[model samples]
Target: MKDSFCVTVTGQSLIKNDVRQIQHKRFLEVLDFLRQGNVVFTNFESTILGRYGGWPTKGRYFDYSRPEMLDALQTMGFNALALANNHAFDLGPAGVLSTLGEVWSRGFLHAGIGTDATDAMKPGRQRHGGHDVSLFAMDAGPGPGNMYAEDRSNGRPPRPGVNQLKTVRKLGVTKESFRTLAMLAQELRTSSLELTNYAQPDDPTAVIGENELNFYGTVFKQGSAFRRHVEIDPENAGEHLAAMQRAAARGDFVLAYLHHHHWEPGWQEVPGWVQGFARACIDAGASVFVSHGAPVLQAVELYKDAPIFYGLGNFLFHVPAEETEWSAREVWRSLVAACRYNGSGQLESIDLLPIVIGGEEETAANRLVPLAATGEVARNILQGFAKRSSIFGTEIAISGASARVSLAAARKVG
Candidate 1:
């Protein structure tokens, strides 16, 4: 292993265009910055199309990329990819196999989707710059159950799909509201047996402590106020953490990545459970933790000498012309994080380079390319980032068009 190493992490890439054709100066500069890291990581948000042949699965929007799209990502110097996002199953099992085949052919270190549950849960390991790097990736979804990978059992064949970190949504309601729901269930003659049969295999309808009820498939808990909670399944979480521990025990640099769509009501707010989970991963021996789902930057934390990025937003978000939701500035603003570790595998510092997708002049031709942010735009982005990081007691120092997290200072206060 090398005495020191650097790893670069960026937001999800939902690219569909041949961005390598772009030669904008700022965009090229971003590419150069990414190449500086021994391992450049990004989530490949779109599944490959046509090569292996498949039909579109149901989704609010279907994202399919051509084979050459991988070339564009490689051109940007991304050698590590997470393939377990919601869109991984957009074209069914064949699409998963196609994507896996294409990514493998390109010699990229990738994880997440696989031919079965065991395969999906396994980490992707590679040796880069004299460092053994291991990546464990999964998706926490409020998505269709069938989209997740399943192992073969009872004479059935295994399913090819994304690695899943199962989570359940619990609705917290007032005592009165719970009573009303129970009464309505009785009035409608809702059958518990039928509800259980229709529920996902891992989530069954049940009652708890006389104050909680699983009506239909939703679990409602009696509480002081109405709220929503996302609970990670311990068994699923344990499996992923165990994988990280095993990798770290082997003296590998472990990277844990999670993709989820369970955003807080305030899109930019980091969920408490996610914070707990990321910390748990570090405790389990992850060298770094990163998550993406909310299409906006959230927060960054330096915990126990490891960096945790709650959300990294979008890097290359290409959507249909009709998709105007992405036009919002927040969706286009993000930063590329370069983390440097010392000889003993302790974090030394982090350089945050603020970037804006499509640059100042966003047009059809350059809409999905990311460019370096400068002047007022850069300061504003870094300021907002600093404010968000402050929530976790992470102090970021802004300088010129970029920001940095120094390990010595972070340790002094952490």
Candidate 2:
């Protein structure tokens, strides 16, 4: 094993246009720092295509980048990109294929989508500093069945799509809550058939799949009250676990990443099932488990000597350029996680670098640039990290300009 090596991770990056004009000093400094890492990772949040060639889909916004835009990411030093988010199918199968072609042609390692289910499940491997690091990407975004690739089951050919993990939504509540739901259902005159299986909408194009929203869920008894929970499909989890194990067997280091958009009632907190899912990944042989989605930073948890970043926020926020879907400012706050491991394969350091997103308006020369947060902005970003990670007992202390997370303390139970 190498004495030490760093792995840098970032959240969503959508380069709607070109990135050649960006020249922010601090931002470039951060990019240089990422370039120094053994493996630089980020979520390829948007597709790369010259024009839309796929069937029309249902989404408020669809994002596609020019081929030249890839030069910017390559210049920024992104070695691997995860492509299993909600927008993977924004432009449909043709878009997904185009995105894959662009990334591969650029010679960057990528995971999360493939020509078939087996191919999608395969991990992306890269050698850095003499250490073989493998990356496995999966997404659990809420969508129709077609969002994910399918195996050649029932004598059918394999399908082209993204790697997906299924989520089982359950309603866990007290007796009173169940009674209230029952009363509400009665008021709506909802029949049992409607509750169990929803009727397909008259317009087939209206729904991405058979259904999108799940109002009813299977009930379970937890002591005196009911427990509602959205758990990962055990079979799907097993498949991912097997993939992680296979990667571990072939590589010196393995990292499993997830693009999960599911959040708790309060958007700030991560769903309970995700926490378990992280641990399961670790148990399955992943040295690190990173997650991004929600386009906002969330909590950080260290479980069983492995680190789990629930959400990394947005590293490069340039999407929704045409139609307004999300608050621009809220999506701008972002960070870069630098993880270092010793020769013994133990995590030795984890640093959080805060950044503020800038657009062409801020800098007449650039479209979307992420500058290192400083002064009040730095403090505020670090404070936000502290607040979000505090729930997991991970503390972030201001260390010069960027904040440092004490992984030694994080080694304790979380």
Candidate 3:
């Protein structure tokens, strides 16, 4: 006989209220499906209060929710959580400590935020269906202070924060654009002509060339225009890869997740580095690569037969009343990814459950809850997924309210 396992991964959850009152028929069906999986994972997108600390006072703005809601989450069948989002440190280290204790006390497994760099970067381990499963999470979004866990430094202690994939950004532009900027700067400096149309760089120093300009180590190749790009820091990304590799070497199935909001021009399209990083994670033995924080549905790809969800959108988002964006149709729609693994630890298939947030009436009285999409809504959601996934040559077939992708059709590499 062969052994198998199943896991369902959802997106960011801003659970501000208890979920015990959920009694709708369609919504209950989705919850029951979630309970059928061996592991249910979600990204906790709010800070758990250690004390009576109210909402954010000075730092970055984020919703503050009571930690008691953990009970509701567990009751809803979420046994695992990723805590590397922007709100993880909204209340500082005490909040993280409280959350760590609460999650552990409730017998829930979580990773990506902790007392220090090591604690935050360590994988959360669980045994399911005669196999060890490890979950490693990180945040690739940009932020300052407490956003990234710090290691011990020269006479400085390690600071508590979230596991981070720090990235280096570079602005790329063509030589023609560089020359135009240089000429403008020269005119601005030589002549006291103050122009508002042409924005000035922080530094007035300009290095212009006929072929190419190397201005203060910022390279400008022969191109058309300017665009910003990012590369994951080698040391930071290497540490995460090593962790996943170690977990796989120990015979534990590894699920590596990241929270990132950096997208391409469109909300659904991701940058090239995201694709590269997902593929590299699979190469390092990750069974799946899950990404969120965009709060919008993105494309899904099969890299090396492992599922890569660029964005899962919101699963349970009930923010403050001022969060008007939640009313948008896109933010209220997402998919629940159910991944099946075979006896040999190879992916067998993927089932996508189309879900719509908000109630059927779409009124203010409707609270935040994910209901199963039916009829036209179901077809549209699945169609959008198929269209986006087509770019990766992955086809999704819709049946009822669910879409599926069998591993047999997934692209394989030599």
Candidate of highest lDDT: 1
- Residue-wise lDDT of candidate 1 within 72-179, one digit each (tens)? 899889999999999999999999999999999999999999999999998999998778999999999988888999999999889999999988878999988999
**Can you list the residue pairs that collide in candidate 3?**
none
* Predicted candidate 3 versus true structure: per-residue lDDT over 1-414, tens digit per residue: 348888898878888888778899888978987886788999988778965343452442566678778888998899989988888877777677777878888987789897888889999998876778898989887655445677888997887778888765456677767777667656765676543323242222233355444444343444567776667888889889988999999888888899876666577777789889988899999988899877788888888788899888888988777767667677878888889888887788889888888644555566578888888888888899889887987878788879898566775432
Error of 1 at 369 (Å): 0.3
Q: In candidate 1, which residue pairs get closer than 3 Å at backbone N, Cα or C atoms, i.e. clash?
A: none
TM-score for each candidate, following the candidate numbering: 0.96, 0.85, 0.87
RMSD in angstroms, all models?
Answer: 1.9, 5.0, 4.8
Give candidate 1's error at residue 406 in angstroms: 2.6
**Across residues 241-327, which tens digit of lDDT does each residue of candidate 2 receive?**
988887777655888889876666556578778888898899888988888877777778777777788888887767554545455
> Where does candidate 2 stray beyond 4 Å?
50-52, 171-228, 321-325, 359-367, 412-414
Count backbone clashes in candidate 2: 4
Badly placed stretches (over 4 Å) of model 1 are 190-207, 362-365
The lDDT of each candidate is 0.90, 0.74, 0.79
The per-candidate count of clashes, in order, stands at 0, 4, 0
**Once superposed on the true structure, which residue ranges of model 3 sit more than 4 Å away at CA?**
51-60, 173-223, 411-414
List clashing residue pairs in candidate 2. Answer: 170-229, 171-228, 172-227, 172-228
Q: lDDT at 31 for candidate 2?
A: 83
